[model samples]
Target: MNFKELRDLFIREGAEFYNQEEASALFYRTLDQLLGWSRTKAVTSLDKYIEASDLPKYLEVLEKLKSGQPIQYIFQETWFYGFPFKVNSGVLIPRPETEELVHWIIETLKGQNGGSLLDIGTGSGCIAVALKKSLDGFQVSALDVSVDALEVAQYNAAMNKVVVNFIEADILAYSGTESFDLIVSNPPYIKEDEKPKMHENVLAHEPHRALFVSSENPLIFYKAIADFALVHLNPQGLLFFEINEYLGKETVEMLELKGFKRVTLKSDMQGKDRMVSCSI
Candidate 1:
């Protein structure tokens, strides 16, 4: 079928799986990308017939969607910070809230001079690449525990034409030689008990290690990162985290207890307390 027919079919048959608007958007976006057709052109040619050979690909995508797989995974890439980033089962899909976190760091470090910046859990290297791209004057490096995630991150760094030093090490177990001017992380802040509360799209497709923290120790990564920063960050250097909305106050408190000064908690566009920044 043509673009309009496929979208209509998706909306009707996939209503139980996705809302009308979501299904419509996913179907059209997928069609545009798979067929390399402009939306305007596809709209005007709604009545045109699609080839029989393309039907299998359409049906396969629909089946995956019906099973609650995220469309970004099907596409194998996502746009973040206005750049195309490769993603897969090994990494979490970039979120709008995280983009806000990256923007905050970019603004915070723009005028600062010749100091190294470290990004923890740099899945897909979206934040690290974006920061280096925006602030060419600063030294940027990123580390991840998963080698698979680092491979994708490295590819993304190359794809974006940004220089980000990538390290394959768990931040929890890492011992490095250098100190940083800034340390930023968007770690696995979701507690295990909160998994059932998440959308099927996330729980079903995203990497568990990249999305979860133990319910018994919700601040595990945060505590480790904060302690690491206390020793690894220069005096007056900043520590930033994209936090779980439920634990904003606790995160800020943790940072303060680590001897960080000027702790600040900020909300994202949805007004949830999603970011916390502090200085050593």
Candidate 2:
């Protein structure tokens, strides 16, 4: 089939799932991936014919999308902060809010030198790798409780061409002796009760191990990371968290009660409270 025919078919088949524009974009992106051609190339060569064998491959991907699987996982990759990272069901896809948190950290530590940072529960190592990439002469290390998640994170670090120390240890039961100048985490803060409120695409495709907490202890990861930061963070070292929107104030209060100085909660682009930064 020719590109035009395939495009028309995709628009018709995808109409039930996505709008016309959305389906067009998805089709072009998928075509770019399968054919390794840019959108401009795909367009200028619209009359080019697709192989008979390749038609089934495109159909299968469309069916998966119709089934609610995220396109990033379908491609086994995603771009974050302008860097490409591999992804899968084993790790949560990096969110835009998390990118904002990384930006805030970068802005806060601009012109710093050789400061060590520890990323707890670093599922995809997006934060850790981005920080290391932006900050010069900075030391960055990340730890995750899951071996599968750690594998994905390690792959991301390598793909981004940044060095990040990866450790396998659960924060709830693990104790840290190594000190860091900055400690950061975007831990599992989504409460179990909130599951019904989340999109099925997320719950179905993303790793729950990296996403949820019991309602009774939604702040469990934060508390554990904060406690460790109290001792392991250097004097006045900063601690950053990408927190749940509903728990912003509570998270700040927890940090303040822990004697962290200058506890501050920040909102995302959509004006929702989604981040917390404080000092030990």
Candidate 3:
């Protein structure tokens, strides 16, 4: 079959599982990645023949998508902050809102550096590596409880040509004397019960350890990281968190009760409280 036919097939079949725009975007992006055919080229060369060898792989991926697998998992890579990250079932797919958090950190430190920064629960090393790439003068390190997740983070650091010290340790048990000028985390903040509100693809494909926290104590990671910051952060050091939207007020209260100063909660592009920053 020709390219147009394949595109039509995706629109028709994928609509059964996903929305029209989502299905089209996934199909075109997968095609571009697999065959180096841009959407414009696919459109202009409507009659371009599908390769005999490539069709099988495309069909298989489409089947997986129909089965509610995330496209990023099928591809095993995603772009964050204009850089590529290798990802799989072990890591949470990087979100655009987290990019905003990174941008805020970079903007906050635009003219200053030569200090250390730590990314707690740094899945895929996205924050740590991205910070290193943007702030070459700063030392960057990342820690995660899951060694498997750390492996993906380390690989992404290498792929992005940034050096980040990767540590395997639970945030609750971190005991290093090393201090940092900044500490940041996008830790698992989704409560266990919120799973029903999430898309089936996310629930099925993403690692639960990288996505959930207890409903009773939704700020579990935040509290641990904040406590760690109290001990390990240099004077005037800042702490940043990508937070749960529903618990923004509670998160801010926890940080303040922990004696953190200048506590601030910021919303994402969608205007939901999604990030917090403070200093001690």
Candidate 4:
């Protein structure tokens, strides 16, 4: 079948489960993966016909989508902060909001001397790796409790050709011997009570431990990190977090209680308060 025919087939068969546009896009994305073609190349070359043997793979992917698997997982890779990163069930997928957080970190630290930087809960090492790639003369370390997540993160670090110190330790329980010039985290902040309100795409596909905090203490990671920063961050060092949009005020308060100065809460592109930066 030609590209146009396969696109039509996906839309006709899976359009009810996935929207027309999304189903169509999925078709092209899968074809691009199989053929290693750019989108423009793939679409403009519609006259090229697909082999009969490739039909089964296309149908299989469509059925998986019908069952609600995320397209990124289906593709087994995703682009984050303009870098290609591998992802799977072991780690939470890198998100656009988190990209904004990374962008904010880069912009905030612009023209500044780079020293030691640490990322807590460094799933896939996205934040740590992105920072190391963007900043000069910076020492970067990333920590995560899950060994499996760390493995994926290390692979991503190597793939991106950026060196990041990957440490396996629970940030909450870690004893720090070295102070850092900057510390950043995008820790679990979604409260259990708020889970029902989140989209199924997130609650179902993403790792829950990376998404949620106990309802009794929605600010657990924030408090832990703040306390750590108080003792482990160098004087005049900065702390950054990608916060729960619903609890920006609480995050700011947590930093203030820890005596972090110049606490600033910033909104993401959607105008939700999603990040906080504070200085010691």
In order, the Cα lDDT scores of the candidates are: 0.89, 0.90, 0.90, 0.88
Task: Decide which is better by TM-score, 1 or 4.
Answer: 1
Root-mean-square deviation (CA) per prediction: 1.3, 1.7, 1.1, 1.6
| Model 3: per-residue Cα lDDT over 1-87, one tens digit each | 887787777777887668878888888888788879888876788788878977998888888888888888888989999999999
lDDT of 1 by residue, 61-163 (tens): 9888888888889888899989899999999999999999999988887677677899999999999998888875889999999999999999999999888
Q: All candidates' TM-scores?
A: 0.96, 0.94, 0.97, 0.94
Per the 3 Å backbone cut-off, how many clashing residue pairs does candidate 1 have? Answer: 0
Model 2, position 51, has a per-residue lDDT of 85
For model 3, the run of ten residues with the poorest summed lDDT? 8-17
Q: What is the lDDT of candidate 4?
A: 0.88
Rank ordering of all candidates by lDDT, starting from the highest: 3, 2, 1, 4
**For model 2, how does the per-residue alpha-carbon lDDT over 9-65 read when each residue is reduced to its tens digit?**
878887766788988888899988898989998888879888897789999988987
Q: Would you give me the overall lDDT of model 1?
A: 0.89
239, model 1: CA deviation in Å? 0.7
Residue 210, candidate 2: C-alpha displacement in angstroms = 0.9
Tell me the number of clashing residue pairs for each predicted model. Answer: 0, 0, 0, 0
User: For residues 116-228, could you state the per-residue lDDT of candidate 4 as single tens digits?
Assistant: 99999999888998899999889999999999899989999999998899889998899879889999999999899998887676777888989898989999988988888
- Pairs with steric clashes in candidate 3: none
